[model samples]
Target: MMEEKMEDRNKIKTELIVVIVEKDMSGEVIDAAKQGGADGATVMYGRGSGIHENARFFGITIEPEKEIVLILVDAAIRNAVLCSIQKKIEIDRPGMGIAFVLDVAKVIGSPHLNLMSDITD
Candidate 1:
């Protein structure tokens, strides 16, 4: 019974979508993702050292500031969310940004997810 319950709980697979964009773009990205079916996102500030990201100032190189947006959503909507983000930001263009998806093995401490599972069960 426990095994079956676990399987049922795990039926809704999760995916993590990570978007790295120029500074101050996280809000736009988050809005796009939400429009694409994502619930929410987490944003963090970072710096990039890519060749195109470095700017020379007074003979010194300054790494471009970046914003990392992390969105976790059900696997079923990953593609739609990615497409929405691409449409909004043109992430494919040079220096625009980059986005990737990763399979999430496990997730915890998410009240909404827990509530969803309870409602489904």
Candidate 2:
């Protein structure tokens, strides 16, 4: 049936939202993402363990603070969401943060329905 085919198509395409923000800017980044049409997001705090020698300060340890924000959106609005967060959070600045997107194969839950409804319109 057409409905089954449409559902199968929807199941194949997904938006992956990845945001790496300074620990202090996580809240602002998440708020910007929400304003940009993200239905929900997950935030995790972590310390940067980059192997770059320059990543450290004057012989003392310089641990870069980090927060990772993950939001799974419908494919259509992924770019807009990324741009909105970038604009509001100034992610392009040095040591500020970074955000990227990926393709998702499938997802499970009622939340996907809500996201699909919101993004389709």
Candidate 3:
């Protein structure tokens, strides 16, 4: 049964949707993602050092605060969620931050996986 469960898990493909946005905008992005079929997401605080992150005042460097949102979803909903995020945040604009997707080979002990299985079954 253990091997059977592992095989079932393997059959489910997953993807990670990563969105980096200004700290204040994280909530809006998460809401949009949910509208697009995402179950939920994990957010973390961070600082950006990219070209757009450079700001100086009184000759002192400033690193803008950022929020990194990580959302794991079934591969089937990846595109829908991405599109919804872009539509809400307009990430394509300069200084609006970025969003990307990564293929997840394996996911262990994630409630997101269980949710996906329930939906599929």
Candidate 4:
């Protein structure tokens, strides 16, 4: 029975939120997610677009500042992290940034295995 339960737990799906924000605000975003109970996160520099376009002054392109933060969390904490990020980053405002969730089907890492070990016992 314990073995079966562990297998089931391993099969459970998790959600990952990929957030892109202004370079300066990345720390606030990460802190918000941590307060919301995300286990871990990864951040990197990136560029993206939406309804807004780059501003131009005298025909010079004004590149918008950007940073990408990827957070992997169990499904149970998805909503909390989402709401916290939205509130902290003011994603509803223009030029703020965007965040979206994706399904993580499988995870491979010793940490993940250790996380499941207690269930197997």
Best-fitting candidate, scored by lDDT: 1
Candidate of highest TM-score: 1
Model 1 agreement with the true structure over 4-115: per-residue lDDT tens digits: 7666767888889999999999999999999999999999999998977778999998988999999999888999999999999999999899999998777767865541
Worst 10-residue stretch by lDDT in candidate 1? 112-121
lDDT scores in order: 0.88, 0.74, 0.86, 0.78
The stretch of ten residues in a row with the least summed lDDT in candidate 2 is 112-121
Candidates 2 and 4 compared: the better one by lDDT is 4
Candidate 2: deviation at residue 42, Å?
A: 0.2
- Candidate 4, which segments miss by more than 4 Å at Cα? 1-6, 110-121
Q: Give stretches of model 3 more than 4 Å off.
A: 1-5, 115-121
The TM-score, computed over Cα atoms with residue i paired to residue i, of candidate 4 is 0.79
Q: What clash pairs does model 1 have? A: none
What TM-score would every model get versus the actual structure? 0.88, 0.75, 0.86, 0.79
* C-alpha root-mean-square deviation, candidate 2: 5.5
Residues 27-66 of candidate 2 have per-residue lDDT tens digits of: 8877887888877788898887656412646777778778
- Mark the regions of model 1 whose C-alpha exceeds 4 Å error after superposition: 1-5, 115-121
Give per-residue lDDT, candidate 1, residue 115: 18
Model 2 scores what on Cα lDDT?
A: 0.74
Error of 4 at 8 (Å): 3.8
